[model samples]
Target chain A: GAGVSQSPRYKVAKRGQDVALRCDPISGHVSLFWYQQALGQGPEFLTYFQNEAQLDKSGLPSDRFFAERPEGSVSTLKIQRTQQEDSAVYLCASSFDRSSYEQYFGPGTRLTVT
Target chain B: AQSVTQLDSHVSVSEGTPVLLRCNYSSSYSPSLFWYVQHPNKGLQLLLKYTSAATLVKGINGFEAEFKKSETSFHLTKPSAHMSDAAEYFCVVRGPYSGGYNKLIFGAGTRLAVHP
Candidate 1:
């Protein structure tokens, strides 16, 4: 009955620092997605995974953004050389199947780069 | 490419009055539309979805939206506004994903303010 959960609800990082955001998808969920929400703006897609496979990373803003889900249940989004532009709310969502449109979201981790 | 547009950036309504949040979408194929609500410092919650089922879809908290293919609109509406209804509302469209998965494209969102 638990929903998707993310760790470190808030994170502050210095410029050029590397930060990692974690997401724990709902148990048995086959699809996981990450999104970025800038202030006063809508969320933008970042990446997606099906099981342990990183199927889509086209939405990732830059090469510095890397994501992995080795075990297929917990996924992490790592940003290398963090920049001020990287500041935003990182959101994680999971769905029952790949095609299912209904996604449950986590509270999100707000990252601030200074 | 599929995209969604939330016409209004903000809407204010008095308690017990009607509420309307307009949304229009563009897609190459049949679209799956959804409405999500976000409270401050909280996760997004699903209000309702239109997956090519009924034209009018009802969601949680007495909210509903009518899917109109001709107008390319899926506008959310409620007969009465409650104090708790104040929040940010998003209209999302699912992009065509050939890999058995679809990407969600969200509108800028509409901020709803309820007044007493």
Candidate 2:
């Protein structure tokens, strides 16, 4: 079976530009999450989705950040007017269900804001 | 709030020597702890998890961790270090359950280096 996968792998954006990262969770996974990893730092929670509903977005740093999982399978994290501080590796993870403690992660998309 | 602290920023060991990565956690209630490893340019991989089951948890690649409530620690250990084990390791704790799901809080991480 396939694991979680993310697209772009790497992205370079100018300040104030918008960028979108995609995540494809494993087949049958019902819960998804997004995290951000800064250089030399551990990953921090960003948002979470249960099926098609965005359950928690409290970890999202600012209003410019948005996420959607309309179909309950694939998800996308979008940043509006990206800033230099937003430069980091965007990670996506998924679990089999809401109660499952284990999360499988994607390779992540490294965004560089210049 | 739940959090984890990795006591050491880095650890270097010779191949075939013991490996120890220390982790301490803070939580309001009984916690679920985990150790994850990350290779360069790769995704985080779960090495082991302690979910209030057995106190000593075993994981893949000959790695294991013991959950000690009294010490507030869940340290990872392996009898012998391998060169392939060189990577960044993170100590994680499951956050308070919210709306039927839980997020993860990670420690700063410990970089392990193995020399032959």
Separate clash counts for every candidate: 0, 0
Tens-digit lDDT track for model 2 on A1-113?
88999999999999999999999999999999999999888999999999999999999999999999999999999999999999999999999999998999999999999
Best by DockQ: 1
**Residue range A40-90, candidate 1, lDDT tens digits:** 899999999999999999999999999999999999999999999999999
With candidate 1 superimposed using the best TM-score fit, by how many Å does residue B106's alpha carbon deviate from the native? Answer: 0.3
Candidate 1, residues B2-106, lDDT tens digits: the string is 999999999999999999999999999898999999999899999999999999999999999999999999999999999999999999998887577987899
Query: What are the per-model C-alpha RMSD values against the true structure?
Result: 0.7, 0.6
lDDT minimum window of 10 residues, candidate 1 chain A: A96-105
